[model samples]
Target: MGTEHRTDEHRTDEHRPDVDRALKADCASCFGLCCVALPFAASADFAINKDAGKPCRNLRTDFRCGIHTGLRDSGFPGCTVYDCFGAGQHVSQTTFGGTDWRRAPDTAQQMFAVFPVVRQLHELLWYLTEALKLRPARSLHSEVRGLLERTERLTGLAPDELEKLDVAAHRRDVNALLLRTSELVRAEARRGGKDRRNRRGADLIGARLRGADLRGADLRGAYLIAADLGGADLRLADLIGADLRDTNLSGADLTGCIFLTQPQLNAAKGDSATRLPPELIRPAHWS
Candidate 1:
């Protein structure tokens, strides 16, 4: 998702100056890498099928979407929910030094190949940065910081080096660390309670869970698509990789929830009553 100007209230401790600016999408400073480097099939979310390295038809000469304001109305809702975690600008300006694929035609293939790799690394940086801000995960801060720095360095590597890097192996290492952080934070939230739900990777699609008590729940990688989660108490829940598409989050309290990204919120349904972590803004479509 493109970055918006957030007020002071939206700037929480997780959004400290050190890493906040680096983890947000800045479309103005980018060369529309996402529109050209990523492929999308003609499904419910996209109006047309597009291949990697080929610019979307809506892309303008200035590298902005021609139908950005009416993306959803024009049958390109998927574009509204995609976030590159700031990799687009980093790749366009830093990796390739502001030379767009159109100008440097010879570098087009390598630039496309390197964008996704940097996107993944930047995502891990997002998680590691948040993990460092969790007071309950204080003991693991040093390790998280180390990994965050290493991931930042990886993002700055030359395109060829990044293409050859084993990102999957690196992701495994980062996931393990994040799991430990999740355990520490969730344990603290459920210290005096006995209802510790371990629904990690559970298939709860279309389940009736309105008004459910899901505080401190381990819901990592759960398939919660189209689930009724209205009025649920989801504080401190581990929601990393959970499919929240079309899920009802109206009136649900997601304060302090871990690993909840803007794209996930954009895909789900919510209302003004839904409470969110300070770092994330309510999606405009939620209204």
Candidate 2:
């Protein structure tokens, strides 16, 4: 595989902090941690069952995917949609001091164990950074920035410490902050006379929400797993921390869907008919 190139033109403006770089996946700077550390079952997304701590069959010695550009055609569509939020590179270059797991086989287990924890922390940082940018959440911006700093610090923990850390507890604390931010932002729609749909952390499994107008709705931490959201209008909706697994988004217009991460979209079920923001690439399994 060839080296990947990322131009700074796609980066945030000068007014924003440098955290955006750390929140974007940089595969070239990574050690293919996601390929080796994460397990995947043979499903619609993945063609094969890969055990945790075991390197993927297509991972090269240089820590690059053998079928990088052709992952979807090669039956590894799940790989193409994954984003570590720069945790892979941080684990490779900083956490482990540039030591390849192949060269230091003894450190493999610990490194693999630490990767997911760090990945979770990095994910929080990604959302917090996004929240800080929302003008409506300006009152919470200082706190969001503080949480972002703390989350970034958590990623830099020693491997043993990282493995021992209770990441779920950390996520709980951050989710609360995100929920507050979502409420503040979505309040605008309520003031505009739109329905005040506060479905935060609700069990919406298998709910019928077709053609529902959810513009600027606070959907943070909502359990939308396998819900039928076909043709739903989710513009300007805050989707941070929402569980989108198997959610039907066919014909859904998410043009201004705020804080909707790529991983969330990847976990959901959508089709060619689904509309998405320009920043989000359509999922391969949607075909």
Candidate 3:
């Protein structure tokens, strides 16, 4: 679904406010960490490459992108696609007690380092939370919810603790769970519960798949770099960890696509004719 349809992570009919905040990006309450804590290269997406921890040239003292309204026209189209998953605001308000980098320059280095770590944890939360929402994956709902709670707890760790956290190890663990969940949901996408095509970890870079009926295909971790998916029927497809970089999604229908993150969408090419899952902002680079 688009931008993760928000729902309560209820264990016993209680609304978990903390879990709700873990999924969406609250940019206004953030320190513009994506524009500063992260780096960019001087490509079509950016005017120049910026080093990590260095504030972007277009960043203001107020911690907002100065060229936000005109990012695409201003030669920094990449910025328009970055989503921090609420890690920025949580790092600023909760982790560091609302002390920004400018006001407390001494903490900048450590803050920048921890931003990415928490961001990964939050991204996992987004996936795990969505996994719980799938009716076809009902068998794995308990398992997914458990992982979601643990990932949420990791988001609240102290700065020093978070700095030392092994994020890749945790991501591997979550990936295992999501893989099973994908299989469960995608199985039902086929008529009479037939198995979907399992192209997990296949190298399909630049392969032509235009107008292909790929509904419910298991494309987990598929290397689809630069693959032409124009006009493909991708409804209910499982795209968990699929490398969609440089892939053409122009005029392709992605309605009901599963585990399709914004980062994946940002990496791919698409035009206005592309039918996306609701709430996913179309990339401006796509004409």
| Top model number, lDDT | 1
2 or 3, greater by TM-score: 3
Ten-residue region with minimum lDDT total, candidate 2: 1-10
Q: Stretches of candidate 1 above 4 Å error?
A: 1-16
Clash pairs of candidate 2?
none
Return the lDDT, model 2, position 246. Answer: 83
Q: lDDT for model 1, please.
A: 0.89
How well is each residue in 1-287 modelled by candidate 3, as lDDT tens digits?
Answer: 22233332211232245565666788888888888999889997789989999999988988888888988789986786677878898899999999998899999999999999998898888888667666777778788888888888899999999999999999989989988877766666676666466787889999899998888898878999999999998877888889988899988888777888887898899887788765366765677
- Model 3 quality (TM-score): 0.86
Question: In model 2, what is the error at residue 36, expressed in angstroms?
Answer: 0.7
Tens-place lDDT per residue, model 1, 1-287, is 11223332212364346577988999998989999999999999999999999999999999999999999999999999999999999999999999999999999999999999999999998988888768788888888888988998999999999999999999999999999999988886677867887999999999999999898899999999999999998988899999999999999988878999999999999998888887788888886
For candidate 2, write residues 156-271 as lDDT tens digits.
88888998999999999998898788777777666777666678788898899999999888787899989999989987788887899889998887765688999889888887
CA lDDT, every prediction? 0.89, 0.81, 0.81
Q: In candidate 3, how many Å is residue 240 off?
A: 2.0
Model 3 C-alpha RMSD vs. true structure (Å) is: 4.0
> How many pairs of residues collide in model 3?
0
lDDT of model number 2: 0.81
